[model samples]
Target: MKNFAYTRAGSLSAAAEAASAEGADIIAGGTTMVDLMKIGVRNPDALVDISGLSELEGHEIGADRIRLGALARMSTVADDPDVIAAFPALSESLWKAASPQLRNAATLGGNILQRTRCPYFRDTAYSQCNKRNPGSGCAALDGGETTLHAIFGGSEACVAMYPGDLAATLVAFDATVATRGPGGTRTIPFAELHVLPGDTPEIETVLEPGEIVTAIELPVVPAMRASHYLKARDRESYAFAAASAAVGLEMDGDTVRDVRIGLGGVAAVPWRATAAEDSLRGSPLTEATAREAGRIAFADAQPLEGSAYKIALGADVVAGALLQAKSRMGGE
Candidate 1:
């Protein structure tokens, strides 16, 4: 890694201000940032450590809404009694993510802001990645193996997927991301925090230059307790998702009353499957119906050579997650 000056910030505002300066960045868990720095993908001259900022450290797992501190470790949130009881999908997403060691070290905010795991983008040896170098070209699309590339919300310039599990579950529940920037503190819908990989593939999120995420808030809802997260990967442990789904449903006599579905490992952003929700809402819950809903979720997915199989795998995973969620509705 490059030699960088580090200063621990006393407050979130101070950290934000320091990070606003040129060649400065914020370090939370140091899992993602440090890895990128070591790989030469990111080289910040100065790093403002926000791990000690008290304002960004606690959880409010209340009856009305759950507020998760940005600096809260993934393992802490996953083990919280209220989180496990109220938001199974949220807890499951974290538990099924990276290994236990990583979960203990990684913070909630850092996980959401994690960079793509695309080989071309990570390895500086490849010179054709547009996300790493804007307008350069995408090697993955040009005869490069793209089994893990995005099929939805991807432009020709970039096909890399947003490799995170927590954000997918948060998006499914319509969580709000609270941030403090130069202007002031504000809350934005979690869905809007991540941008689609359009022409500007390099710009990943809606967070302004000086903005620092403070917390994530999710409203307590009846459906959330019955939610479940299912991931399909090549290996059982320490493997990225090949296709994953976070599903929550409110059922009325075997019929769906309301539903929320978020798809991961298949898109540029944490994909909220609105069409799938539309298909399931107010409809009888069955294998056939769930499969149809899954198909609707990927109606707009444009797959490349190696990723074409993901379309079918993603649909099956969605269907399975819906069934799993429905089975858990009895407890709620």
Candidate 2:
């Protein structure tokens, strides 16, 4: 928000070097960064804009994975024929995310890296938010209702949830995030990118300062063709989820051989509901089992004051999402 020097790098390495230095930040799509700046939540001394780097541009949807360019716009990825056909969950999450203009300007990597939608953090009116100032304490915990706060991996300190929808799709598909820096290239599991707030909400990810995301790779799954992302929000459209489910089920005849389950709106990160997934992995695909799996996903969720509905809503979400996915199979 304050006056900051800007540099547009020609290469990823150049961008990394500029960003890795002191008080420098990376700006790819600039959607999230600009918003944070406007709210006084982000004030960098200098910004290294990496949107110009050719090394971080373009993509290929493969049989094993969809190799995503860091700079690929959300609209482009959502509208790609292969993405629409092969990854219905991924495509749907993108399309359901924001307005058309926002999707056009927001890059895929930036969307995944976007921050929480927590009101206290966004407003900057509250001076006691620990995420904004360490040791300042969290006002959301005692002052506001925590229905939208986290139920997993939350410390007494903070409960801000990861507010991205696309990340849930990536988690369901077992995706990998690719990054590059002076140390060369390394790929991290998408699940590992986000960390629970625990005691440090300011430190959101593992990316060292100055590192630039190169790509995100999602594993291929035939189940994805039978997958769906169901978001239960306050409204039909243009609203963040109240509770959501991403489900992909593989059937061996009438029985399910494998299932991938990921949840949103109830946790600090894109939650891979392995317990729910385990419930459905080798069982018969029935509405009962799907609902039970949904129940298992939230078994460990400890709602604060008002979010206890997330437990029931989360169960219905998984059930609804799985049932919707099953109906999509050809000749179902």
Top candidate when judged by TM-score against the true structure: 1
Q: What is the per-residue lDDT of model 2 for residues 1-332, given as tens digits with 9 covering 90 to 100?
A: 69999998887888888888888988988889999998899899999888877766777877677798999999998898988888788888988888888999999889998888888888787887888788788877876867788877777888887778888888878899999876777899999988888778778888987777889987787889888999988888778888888888788888887788888888888889998888887677778887888888999998887777889998999999998888888414
lDDT of 1 by residue, 170-229 (tens): 998989999998778999999999998888999999988778999999998888988999
Residue 174 lDDT (model 2): 89
The lDDT values for all models are 0.91, 0.85
- Cα lDDT for residue 24, model 2? 92
C-alpha TM-scores of all predictions: 0.98, 0.97
Q: Considering only N, C-alpha and C atoms within 3 Å, which residue pairs clash in candidate 2?
A: none
For all the candidates, what are their Cα RMSDs to the real structure? 1.4, 1.3
